[model samples]
Target: MIEVIGLTKRYGGKTAVDDLSFTVRPGHVTGFLGPNGAGKTTTLRVILGLDAPTAGAVTVDGVPFRTHRRGLHHVGALLDAQQVHGGRSAQAHLAALARSNGIGRRRVGEVLAEVGLADAGHRRIGGFSLGMKQRLGIAAALLGDPPVLMFDEPINGMDPEGVRWVRHLFRSLAAQGRTVFLSSHLMTEMEHTADHLVVIGQGRLIAAEPLRAFADRGTRQRVTVRTPQPAVLAAALTAAGASVDTAPDHLAVRGLSAEQIGALAFANAVELHELATHTTSLEEAFMEITAGHADHLAGSR
Candidate 1:
C-alpha cells in the first residue's frame, strides 16, 4: 500500500503539488488522473524520493521508499520508457538492475519472457520501436517481482494487442493482492482497468474514490425512453419535474430515475417499449468535474 499525506511540493516560488492526501490500498488497480501541468509527475517523483516534498510525507508500506536497501523488491516503477540507455541490449539493462538489487540473473530471462521481449532481449534498445521500448521498460519493472508497482503512461505508443495485454496484466497483478498504481491520459482504458481513481487538478485533489462513485458525480443523469406515445410520456415526465427532450421516436429525460419514470408511465397509461438509463462515462465525468481546473484552454475558432 502507498500512503501520501498532505503532500506538497514547490519549486522556488511556484507550487506543483499542494496538500494532497490519498491512500492507494492493496488488491486494487488505482488510476492517477490529471490534466496537463496538474503536478502528477511531480507527485510521483516525490513519492519515489527523486524529489523532496516541501511538506507532508509519502510512504510505501510503512516507511519511505528511500529507506529500502533493495528498493526494487518493494516497489517497481516505470516513470519514463525513453530514459533507458539506447546503446544497451534489453537483457543487459535488466541484468544490470538485477545485479545492483541482488536479484538473480535467472530473473532477467523470466521478466523478459513475461513481457514478450524474450526474442528481442538481445537486440540493442536503439533499434526498438516505441512500443517495443515500453515492453522492455515493463520487463524491467517486473524483474524484481515487487509487490507494489507504479506505472506512468505505460500504454503510450503500444499497439492494440499490447494495450490489451497490459490491461490484463495490471488487473492480474492487483488480483494477486499487490498494489498497482497507474497514470494514464486514456479515460476509456482507465474506465476498464481501474477499480479506484485519484483525480487531481492544478496541484490539488479533485477526488479520490471508487471509479463508479467518481463517475456518478457527473452533472447529468439522463434516461432514454422509446415509446409509441412519446407525447404522453413527455407530458407525464415533465409534470413530474423531469426535463424531457422529445424526438420523433424517443424522449431523453433528466432529473428522474428510471424506476420513477416507469412508475410515472404506468400511472399515465403510457406504453413503453424501451427505458434505459445512460450514466456518464469516465471521460465525460472528468471533463465536467475539471472544467474549471484546466491549465490551458484553447480559444474558440
Candidate 2:
C-alpha cells in the first residue's frame, strides 16, 4: 500500500503539487493520470523519494521507502526504460543492479526469464530496440521480487503485439496479488488496465474513483433509430420528449428505449430500417471529462 498525505512540492514560486492526498491500496492496479507538465512525473519523484516534497510525506506499506526493510525488494518500479547504460549487455546491466542491491544471481535469471529476455540476456542494450528495452526494464523492476510495482508509460514505443503483451502482463501481475501502479497517456489502454484512476490536472487532483464511474459520468446511454421516414421520425421523437439528432439515414436519439422507439414507429405506422443502442467508447468519455475541465479552467484563466 502507498499512502500519500498532503504531498506537496514547490520549485521557488511555482507549486508542482498542491497539497495532494490519496491512498493507493494493494490487490489492484491504480492508474496515475495527467496531461503534460501536470506534475505527474514530479509526483512520482516525490513518492519514490527521488525528490523531496515541500510538505507532507509518502509511505510504502506504512513507512517511507528509504526506511523499509529490503526497501528495493518491497517496491519495484520501471519509470524509464531508457535509463539504462547503453554500453552494457542486458544481462550485465541487470547483474550490476542485482549486485548493488544484494539481490541474488538466481533471482536475476528468474526475472530475465519472467520477462522473456533470457535468450537476449547476453545481448548489448544499445543494440536492442525500444520493445527490448521495455522488457529489460521490467526485468529490473521484478528483480527485487517486490509485491508493489510502479510503471510510468510502460506501453510506450511498442508494436501492437508488444502493447497487447504488456497489457496482459500487467493483468497477470495484478492477478498474482501484486500492487500495480501504472501511469499511461493511453486513456483507452488505461480504461482496460486500471481498476481505479487517480486523475490530476494543473497539478491538482481532478477525480479519483473506480475507472467505470469516471467513464460512466461522461456518457449518456443513447439509442439510434433508422427509418425511411427520417424527417417524419425526428419530429415524432421530439414530440415524445427524446432528444433527437439528424443522421444521414437515421435519427440519433437519447432518453428513449428501443422498445419505446419501436412502439412509436408502430403507432405512427412508420417503417424502420435499423434500431440499435450505442454504448459510448472509453475515449469519448475521457475526452468529455477532460475537455470539460479544460474549458472550465480556460474560462477562469
Candidate 3:
C-alpha cells in the first residue's frame, strides 16, 4: 500500500502540492486524476523520492521508498517511458536496472516477454516507436516483480491492442493483491480499468472514493423513457415536477426516478414501452467536479 499524508511541495514561491493526503490500498487499481498543471507529476516524483517534499511524508509498505536498498523490489515505477538511454537495447536497459537492484538477468528476459517485447529486446531503444517504447518501459517496471507499481500515462502511445493489454495487466496486478496506482488523462480507459479514484485539482485533493461513488456525484441524473403515447407521457411527466426533453420517439427526463415515472405513467393511463436510468459517465463527473479547478480553459473558436 502507498500512503501520502499531509504532503506539500513548493518550487520557489509557487506551491505545487498543498497538504494533499490519500491512501492507495492493495488489491485495487487506483486511478489518479487531475487537470493540467495540477501537480500530479510533482506528487509522483515525491512519492518515488525523486523530489523532496517541502512538508509531510510518503511511504510505500510502511517505509519511505528511498530507504529501501533494492528499491525496485519494494516499489516499481515508470514516470516517463522516454527517460531511458536511447543507446541501449530494451534487454540491456532492463538488465542494468535488475543488476542495480540485485535481480538476476533471467528476470529481465521474463519481463520482456511478459510485456510482449521479447522479439524486439535485441533492437536499440532509439529505433523503437513511441508505442514500443511504452512497452519497454512497462517491461522494466515489472523486472523486479515488485508488489507495488506506479505508472504515469502508461498507455500514452499504445495502439488499441496494446491499450487493451495494459488494461488487463493492471487489473491482473491488482487481483494478485498488489498496489497499483495509475495516472492517465484518458477517462474512458480509466473508467474501465480503475476500481477506485483519487482526484486532485490545483494541487489539492478533490475526491478520494470508489469510481461509482465519484461518478454519481454528478448532478445530471437522467432517465430515458420510450412510450407509444409520447405526447401523453411527456405532458404527465412535466406536470409531475420533472423536466422532459422530447424526441421523435423517446423522451429524456430529469428530476424523477424510473420507479416514480413508471408509477406516474400508470396513474395517468400512459402506456410505456421502456424506462431506463442513465447515470453520469466518468468523463462527465470529472468535468462537473473540476470545472472550477481547471488552470487552462479552452474557448470556442
Candidate 4:
C-alpha cells in the first residue's frame, strides 16, 4: 500500500504538488490523472524519492522508500521509460539494477519474458523503438517482483497490441493482490484498467474515489429517446419536469432515467423507436472537472 499525506513539492518560487493526500491500497489498480502541468509526474517523483518534498510525507507499505533496506524489493516503478543508458543492452541494464538491489541475474530473464522482451534482451537499448523501450522499462519494474508497482504513462508509445497487453498485465497484477498505481493521459484505457482514480488539477486534489463514482459525479447522464412522435414525447417529458432538447430525430432528456422516459411514452400510447441512457465518458468527465484548473485556456475577444 502507498500512502501520501499532505504532500507538497516546490521548485524555487513555483509549487508543483500542493498538500496532496491519498492512499493507493493493495489489491486494486489506482489511476493517477491530471491535466498537463498538474503535478502528476512531480508527485510520482517525490513518492519514489527521485525528488524531495518541500513538506509532508509519502510512503510505500508504511515506510519511506529511501529508508527501506531493500527498496526495490518492496516497490517497483517505471517513472521514465526512456531514461536508461543507451550504451547498454536491455539485459545488461536490468542486470545492473538487479545487482545494485541484490537481486539475482535469473530474475532479469524472468521479467524480460514477462514483458514480452525476451527475444530483444540481447539488443542494445539505443536501437529499441519507443514501444520496445516501454516494454523494457516494465520488465525492470517487475524485476524485483515487488508487491507495489507504479507506472507513469506506460502505454504512451505502445502499439495497439502492446497497449492491450499492458492493460491485461496491470489487471493481472492487481488480481494477484499487488498494489498497482498508474498515471496515464489516456482516459479510455484508464477507464478499463483502473478500479479507482485519484484526480488532481493545478496541483490540488480534485477527487479520489472509485472509477464509477467519479464518473457519476458529473451532471452528464442524459436519456436519449428516438420516436416518430418527437413533438409529443418532448412535450410530455417537459411537462413531467424533465429538461428536453430536440435533436434531428430524438429527444435528449435530463432529470429522468430511460425507464422513466419509456414509461411516460408508454402511458401516452406513444410508439418508441429506441430509448437509451448516455453517461459522459471518462474523458468528458475529466475535462469538465479540470476545466477550471487548466494551465492553458483559449478565449477570443
Off by over 4 Å in 1: 227-232, 269-273, 296-301
lDDT of 1 by residue, 1-301 (tens): 9999999888776888889999999999999998888888888888899999999999999899999999999999999999999999999999999999999999999999999998998999999999999998888889889999999999999999999999999999999999999999999999999999999987889999999899988758899999989988888888889999988779999999999999999999999999999878899999999888887222200
Kindly indicate the candidate among 2 and 4 with the higher TM-score.
4
What is the number of backbone collisions in each predicted candidate, taken in the order shown? Answer: 0, 0, 0, 0
- Candidate 2 per-residue C-alpha lDDT over 253-297 given as tens digits, one digit per residue, 9 for 90 to 100: 998888998999898888998999987876777767676444222
Per-candidate TM-score against the hidden true structure:
0.91, 0.91, 0.91, 0.93
**Model 4 pairs in collision:** none
TM-score of 3: 0.91
Query: Over the stretch 1-301, how does candidate 4's per-residue lDDT look in tens digits?
Result: 9999999888876788889999999999999998888888889888899899999999989988999877779999998888999989999999999999999999999999989988988999999999999999999888888999999999988999999999999999999999999999999999999999999987889999999888888648888888999998889998999999998978899998999998899999899989989889999999988889887212200
TM-score of 4: 0.93
The TM-score of predicted model 1 comes to: 0.91
Global lDDT of each model? 0.92, 0.83, 0.92, 0.90
lDDT of 1: 0.92
Select the stronger candidate by lDDT from 3 and 4. Answer: 3
Please list all clashing residue pairs in model 3, or write none if there are none. none
Which candidate should be chosen as best, given TM-score against the real structure?
Answer: 4
Backbone clash total, candidate 1: 0
